[model samples]
Target chain A: METSVLKSKLQSYRELALKGINHYVPKSEPRKHLYDLVMDYPSRGGKGFRPGLCISTCKAWGGNEETAINSATALELFHNAFLVHDDIEDGSEFRRNKPTMHEYNNIGIAINVGDAMNVLSIKPLMMNINILGPELTWQIFSEIEHMVRQSVEGQAMELGWRKENSKCLTEDDYLRMILKKTCWYTTIHPIRIGAIIGSKGKVNPDMFNRFGFFMGTAFQIQDDVLNLIADEKAYGKEIGGDILEGKRTLMLIDLIQKLKGSNKSKLINYLANCRNENQLDNASWVLDKMHEHGCIEYARKVSKHMAGAALKEFYTCFQNVEDSEDKDMIEALIMHMISRDY
Target chain B: METSVLKSKLQSYRELALKGINHYVPKSEPRKHLYDLVMDYPSRGGKGFRPGLCISTCKAWGGNEETAINSATALELFHNAFLVHDDIEDGSEFRRNKPTMHEYNNIGIAINVGDAMNVLSIKPLMMNINILGPELTWQIFSEIEHMVRQSVEGQAMELGWRKENSKCLTEDDYLRMILKKTCWYTTIHPIRIGAIIGSKGKVNPDMFNRFGFFMGTAFQIQDDVLNLIADEKAYGKEIGGDILEGKRTLMLIDLIQKLKGSNKSKLINYLANCRNENQLDNASWVLDKMHEHGCIEYARKVSKHMAGAALKEFYTCFQNVEDSEDKDMIEALIMHMISRDY
Candidate 1:
């Protein structure tokens, strides 16, 4: 499949998912302020990749887009809610090249908005009851339960690691964290939920686990790389923001291993200090060290390897299904996400 | 139905609900810190009023405690989650005589813990599939949907009121806010959900609404009065915390009415200022004025009237149902809550 064609397909699905999300524009007069804050990030428009993937997976599994739209919108809403909280926790200033929710509003209001969005997200899943019946809706609900639990657990690990300044961290530890944090919510659950819904509970959800793990990990590493090197305008986020936040990205873990003596101690001190205070100097210093040590290239290579493994897994999982545009797009997404500079 | 007997019944139900909640003490290693923070409030032991009401209501409708335990535990967990967020938003220092979650942990971490607890709370509700089966479980889920939506809407209203400084507020406004915020989650949904489960989804949930509204409102008014007048040791929370937060309590509204000219302006100035900055001196001055202007007495009268209405509503709702220990205790709890000094 051509990259341009795949991009167009992805855009169409994104538009469809956006339409589904517009169903919940939140018009309650009393709490309109909180609801307005919730629509902020979703309206700013990221890749819409989460919902796009969810809808595509459902289509590829022979389900209509309408059947998947509610779940897809839910995926996007939940992701944005997580991002709103994540921005506050990381003390990041920008999301999608705009002020983070807490930066635009106060932290208290931002938290309230995120909480409301979370509760609203549940509405769509429950709506599945009318469309999918009780048993299937219950299964999807349980899957969502696991997905939320895993994502929060992953977030806690990352936050705990930074708070404790855990120096014993390894590349494997970073991978494990992202697998729970990024992989499950980002790729695994979306595919699993979509597959189950599309197949009308016929598909074995566990079968998609390995493929989602590899694909989502690849996407995350590429994202980390883009944070360091991509133009801020193209990336739609602050360049090198992860280093400033002391996020345990693979590049950071690799750089830590390559550094010796004073460089190592300097990096350690920066991580130990308050991220908001040290962001600028820390980002520049870390970026320089990563470039000098070839850690960025190292992470890129690892990401490509993961993408390759994902391609292989994709063939195994989709082998039984008929060829379709949605299937092709899913394959294209894995490649595009891994290889894109922005 | 004597006061002591009612107290004993409430205590036993609280113990059962606590045991049920103990089943979900969150042991995930990566996020144990978050889970531990969540358990802190529930373990420190507030009255256990929410879950006790839920369990007893279930029993009164002829349901076994085992059938209600999961939902009861979920109610407690969800309530604690709200407390964690509410404390941060209100900037209170104490809950159940211990530091608030944000006071013990950073605001960022406390927010995450609350979010985690909110997610963890859903697992038990999902567990209802095995115990209650899908049809009844879906009904319960629908009830929770209303419960969470109402609670957040109520929170948004209260927060918006403080933010906008709505000086033309009436006692009717206070009632509307508390009805949404306190009454629904505290009384209405619990009885609705309990009756539905106990009657195997046969009861009309609407039947419990009026009864719950009056009972919960009476309970809330008594709680507000206790905050003003109860001894610190007996209250188990920071006395005058609500005044310090400039909460639009009935007594506060009454105090504003009783004051004249400069005193009214002075109080308005205090309410409009940042609460955290004004908490100490404002609490002292407001307490004095409440005493001087008979504001406390006025509030007590209103609360007593509400309690009387609740007692009448209780008989109307429960008269046709079988007379049991649970029913008798529910009747006694109304008088006990309103009449207690501490």
Candidate 2:
């Protein structure tokens, strides 16, 4: 698919998902503290990767857009909910080039708003019962259950790593963390849910797991890369945020492994600065080291390899399914993940 | 219906529900930051009124204890999750005679733990598919969905009221807030859920709403009263903590209404200190004013009347059901809510 075509397709999916999200958020009183804030993150114009992936996969597997809209919207809401909490967890100041929900509001209101978003997400799934029937609705619920658990478990792993500041982390650990944290909800489950809904629960969702894992890991690595290199206007978040937060990206792990003696200790001390003092200088130093040690280049190569594998797995998973624009969109999305400048 | 009998029944039900909660909490890696903290609030030994109400109501409606256990456990987990976040929102220092989760750990860890708890609560509901079947399982999910929404809405109302510092609040506002916040989830839904399961979704759950609302409001008022007067050891929380948080309790509103001139301004100024300065002196002054202005007495009377109405509504709601220990336990539980010193 042409890049313009892909962008338009993503825009359409995001619009549909946003409509579904707005329908669920109550417009009653207490708007300022809760409901309005619940809509804030969704309205901030996310790429809608989750909803797009879900809807396209559903269509690819023969389901109509209506059958998938509610679940797609739920995925978008869940994504926003996670981002709200993740921002607070990471003490991130910006989201989508705007102040984070917690930063704009107080922690108390932000926490409550995130919670309200979570509660609101359930409405879409419950509505699925009427459209999809109880059996299929229950299946969707089960899919969401696993998605949420995996996401939180992944979050727990990442948070634990940051808290302990474990320097001796491995590539396998990074992969495992991303698989649980980013892959399941972000890519794997969206596809699984869409396919299940489209195929009427006949498709073996496990077939998409490997494809999603490879694609999601690559997507996450690319996201980290963009955080370091993308233009401030295009990235929609503060550059080098991962470094200041001491996020354990692949580049950070590789850089840690490469440094020796005083250099290694300096990197360790920078990582240990949990209070985030002198963040600009420290982040710049770490970013420079990542370049000098070829960490960023190494991450890019790994991401490319993963994307290549995802393409292979994608073909394997979708071989029997009939071809359509939706299928093409999925392939293009994978390519976009690695190839996009922003 | 003896108080001691009710105590023992509550104890048994609490133990059963805690076992279920423990079963659902993952015992995997990332123990310190997530799972262990997920278990912390439950392990602090809550009164388990929610689970008790749910289980007994189910049995009273002819449901087996085994059938109601999972839903009851889910309710308990949700209650703990709310408490975790509530403590953070309220800036509470202590709970169950110990430091709040956010106080013991950090905000990020506490928030994530609460999120994890919320995620874990879904497992029991999903497990309901086998025991209750998909149709009934979906009903339970719907019930939980509404319970969560109502609770959050109610929380939003309270949080908004505090944020605006509205001094001209009314009794009606208090009732509406409690109805959404405390009554639905704490009392109403548990009874509705249990009755639904016991009767196999045949009973009209709405019939119990009034009973639940009245009982829940009364329970909340009594809880507020206890926050001022209950023994430090018996209450398991710091006395007058609500005053320090500037919570817009009924007593505070009543005291505001009665005070004149500088006294009224003084009280307003005291409540306006969102930063909680001079907490000890301010909380003490507010408590004394509540006593002098008959605020606590007025609240007590309102609570008693509500409890009396709950008793009447209880008979009307449960009139046709057969009498059993479970039925008696529920009646005793209502009485216990108003009459208990603790």
What are the per-residue Cα lDDT tens digits for candidate 2 across B30-125?
A: 787788888888998878899999999999999989999999999999999999999998889989989999997888888888988888899998
Distance from true position, residue A264, model 1, in Å?
1.6
Instruction: Give the runs in model 2 whose Cα sits over 4 Å from its true position.
Output: B276-278
Q: List the residue pairs that clash in candidate 1.
A: none
Q: For model 1, what TM-score does chain A reach?
A: 0.96
The sequence of per-residue lDDT tens digits that candidate 1 reaches over residues A31-142 is 4557667778888877767887888899899999888888888888889889998989888889987889889766766777788888888888988888988778878888
Docking quality level of the chain pair in candidate 1: medium
What C-alpha lDDT values do all the predictions have? 0.84, 0.90
User: Which lDDT tens digits does candidate 1 get at residues B1-342?
Assistant: 787777677677777767766777666576455677767888887776777788887888889888998898888888988999888878888888778888977777888888888898898888888899988888888888788877877787788787777677789988998888899999899888888888888889898888888888888888898998898877877898888878888998888887899989989988887464745776789899999998889888887788788888888887878998888778878777788766
Question: Candidate 2 chain B, which ten residues in sequence have the lowest lDDT sum?
Answer: B274-283
| Model 2 whole-model lDDT (C-alpha atoms) | 0.90
DockQ of each: 0.64, 0.80
Judging by TM-score against the true structure, name the best candidate.
Answer: 2
Give a tens-digit lDDT track for model 2, residues A51-149.
999999999999989999999999999999999999999999989889998787788888888888888899999899889987788788889988998
Local lDDT at A312 for model 2 = 97
